[model samples]
Target: MINLKISEPNPRESVREYAYRILSENILDLVLVPGAAISEKEISDVLSISRTPVREAFIRLSQEGLLEILPQRGTYVSKIDTEQIAEFKFLRITLEQAVMKLACSDFPQKLQEQLCNCLEKQSICVKKRNHEQFFIFDNMMHDIIFTGCEKSYIWKIIQEANLNYARARVLDLSSRQDEIEVLFAQHKEIVKAIITKDTSLGENIIVRHINKVISDVDDLQKQYPEFFK
Candidate 1:
């Protein structure tokens, strides 16, 4: 048996939680690609941690719908289920639309400044073609808006779904440069709608933006068939 012990404790959690965070991020970012075989031994070697913590992490991700553990076989990243994606789309659109509406009515100036700052960073990343930076900024931008909504439970769900989607999107965006300009333009529109308190326009913009993701899923499946299979 692999010995899974930590000499010290993490400020936020036990060793198991730390392990879960690292492994979950890797899986969600496609660092561990879907359908790519993984073993507890490999995880132990790579993380320099024991199988217990790794197993704990795997269980957490499996609960989050990002990994699968076979009874007798090795663990694997979960396949991209189109039906689940569709459900995600429906829930995200409806909830985010409502959230945007709330933000239009209640967002403070400080929040607007933060969002604009995130947008500026996005523009800089685009000009430099720094995808890693752009990806982080992309997340920050939505996060700011989601925070402005002030719906903690809904935000939690959206955050989870976004994490799952990010792995696939990072791959898709790496090849789809044309999408960059279009996405930025929509971001501007969303910001403008929020600033002007145009709830309808903001909601419409988000709906369209999410639709593009739905459109791109087919391409993602084609490019990374094994991941999706």
Candidate 2:
């Protein structure tokens, strides 16, 4: 097992959620790759916790289809399911598109300020070549949109549905440099649409934004055949 060190568990974060966040990020980043054996004891030991929380994390990952827990064979990272990718991408895009439509009409000034700040931070991350931070800010921007529409529950479901999307995003960031460069500009455009209450423009941009991954899957499959199913 690779050496793992997590930050001191946050007081507000339940053990299981902390463990889940650490393991989930590693899995998504391809550090703990598909088909690799994962030991609950090892992880719990790293986190300086009992096996219970690690096991809880394992159960959650299994439910999200990010890990396969076999009774006799031991737990291993699950191969990326392209089908799940398609389904969840469709679901997320649909939800976000709806959110944009709702949020665009009378888009609150405070939320607009938050989104613009997010976009600015995203621009900085992209310029600094900090792909990880860029991804984090990207999600924050979207979550703000969802929250603006009073659909926080929808954002939770999107997060749960995003295992494959997360992995694919890593690939997307690594490979699509030119388009990634444009993403900040695109984010600005999205915010502009919202500020002006232009739902049609927002929808159009979001569709292209969300579909970029699906459009590039062939290249992803060619690059990492083993990661895909």
How do all models score by TM-score?
0.88, 0.90
All models: lDDT? Answer: 0.77, 0.84
Candidate 1 least-lDDT 10 residues:
1-10
Per-residue alpha-carbon lDDT of candidate 2 for residues 1-229, written as tens digits (9 for 90 to 100): 4665357667899888899999987898777877788899888887788999899999988987899999988999998788888897779788888888998886678988999899889888877888878888988998998888888888988887788888887777877777567677778888889999998999999888888877788788888887787
Give candidate 2's total backbone clashes: 0
Clashing pairs in 2: none
Stretches of model 2 off by over 4 angstroms after superposition: 12-14
Q: For every candidate structure, what is the RMSD over all alpha carbons to the true structure, in angstroms?
A: 3.9, 2.0
- In terms of lDDT, the best-performing candidate is 2
Q: Where does model 1 exceed 4 Å of error?
A: 1-13, 162-164
16-64, model 1: which lDDT tens digit per residue?
7877876776666566777766777877786677899988888888887
| Model 2 TM | 0.90
